[model samples]
Each structure stands twice: as structure tokens, then as C-alpha cells.
Target: MAELWKSLPSWVRNIVVPVLVLVLAWNLVWFVVGVVSSLLGLLIKGLVVVGLAAAVVVLVKKAAKS
Candidate 1:
């Protein structure tokens, strides 16, 4: 593997290799961001649902007390 890499031309080694690495890295970063964004969205939705449920319970208890 090392031998093959070393055998590559200077332009390929210096330019093509770094460009490919950057592209791969950029894709990976976006993938991670997408995953995290989805998770956060779900979390926020879950919290909102829980909050609404709690509010309903509180309101029902107050009405029953009356």
C-alpha cells in the first residue's frame, strides 16, 4: 500500500489526495450534523409533549378540586 502511494505522481499526491480527503471529511461532518439535528428535534418534540401532558394533568386536578 505504501509503495503504491509513493509511486503516485507528485500532483496526484499533493493535490488529488488532499482534495479527496477534504471531500470525505466534509461529507462526514454533514452526516454527523444531520444526525445530531434530528436527535435534537426529536428531543424537543418529546419535551413539548411531556410538558403539555403535565399541564393537562394539572388543569384537570384543579378543575376537580372546584
Candidate 2:
């Protein structure tokens, strides 16, 4: 791998390596953002479902008392 890198021209090593590194870093950040956003969405959906379930239970109890 060292030998292969050595064979490449200086300009490619300088420019392409930095660009590739920046792309990898950018992708990593987006990956984390995507994961966080997905988890947040799931949490919101779960909360909504729970809220609906609680509402139904309360209505059922009120009807039973009547």
C-alpha cells in the first residue's frame, strides 16, 4: 500500500487524499444525524400511540361507571 501510494503523483496525493478524507467525515456526520432523526421519529410515534391508548382506556372506564 505504501509502495502504491508512493507511485502516485504528488498532486494526487495532496489533493485527492484531503478530498476523500473530507467526504468520509461528511458522510459520518450525516450518518449520525440520520440515526438521531430516525430515533426521534420513532419516539414521537410511540408517544402518540400511548396517548391514544390512554384516551381509550379512560373513555371505557367512564362508560362502565354509567
Candidate 3:
């Protein structure tokens, strides 16, 4: 790998490699952000469902007492 890199032209090593690295890093950052956003959305939905279920249970108990 070192030999292959060394064989590449200096221009490629300096310019092309850094550009590719930046592009890949940008994609990786967005990918992580998307995953976190999706997980958070799911978490919020789950919390809403749980809250609604609890509310229903409480209402039912209250009605039963009445």
C-alpha cells in the first residue's frame, strides 16, 4: 500500500486524496446524522404511544371508580 501510494504523482497525493477524504468524511457525517435523527423520531413516536396508552388506562380506572 505504501509503495502504491508512493508511486502516485505528487499532485494526486496532495489534491485528489484530500478531496476524496473530505467527500467521504462529509458523507459519513451526514449518514450518522440521519441515523440519529431516525432513532430520535422512533423514540418520540414510542413515547407518544406509551403516553396515550397510559392516559387511556387512567381514564378507564377513573370511569370504573365512578
Candidate 3, backbone clash total = 0
- In order of appearance, the predictions have TM-scores of 0.90, 0.87, 0.92
For model 1, residues 1-66, the per-residue Cα lDDT tens digits are 999999999999999999999999999999999999999999999999999999999999999999
The CA lDDT of each predicted structure is: 1.00, 0.99, 1.00
Off by over 4 Å in 1: none
Give the candidates in order of lDDT, highest first: 3, 1, 2
| Candidate 2 wrongly placed segments (more than 4 Å) | none
Using TM-score, give the best candidate's number: 3
Model 1: worst 10 consecutive residues (lDDT sum): 1-10
Any runs in candidate 3 off by more than 4 Å, and if so which? Answer: none
The residue-by-residue lDDT of candidate 2 on 1-66, one tens digit each, is: 999999999999999999999999999999999999999999999999999999999999999999
Residue 6's lDDT in candidate 2 = 100
TM-score of 1: 0.90
lDDT of 3 at 14: 99
For every candidate, C-alpha RMSD to the true structure in Å: 1.0, 1.1, 0.9
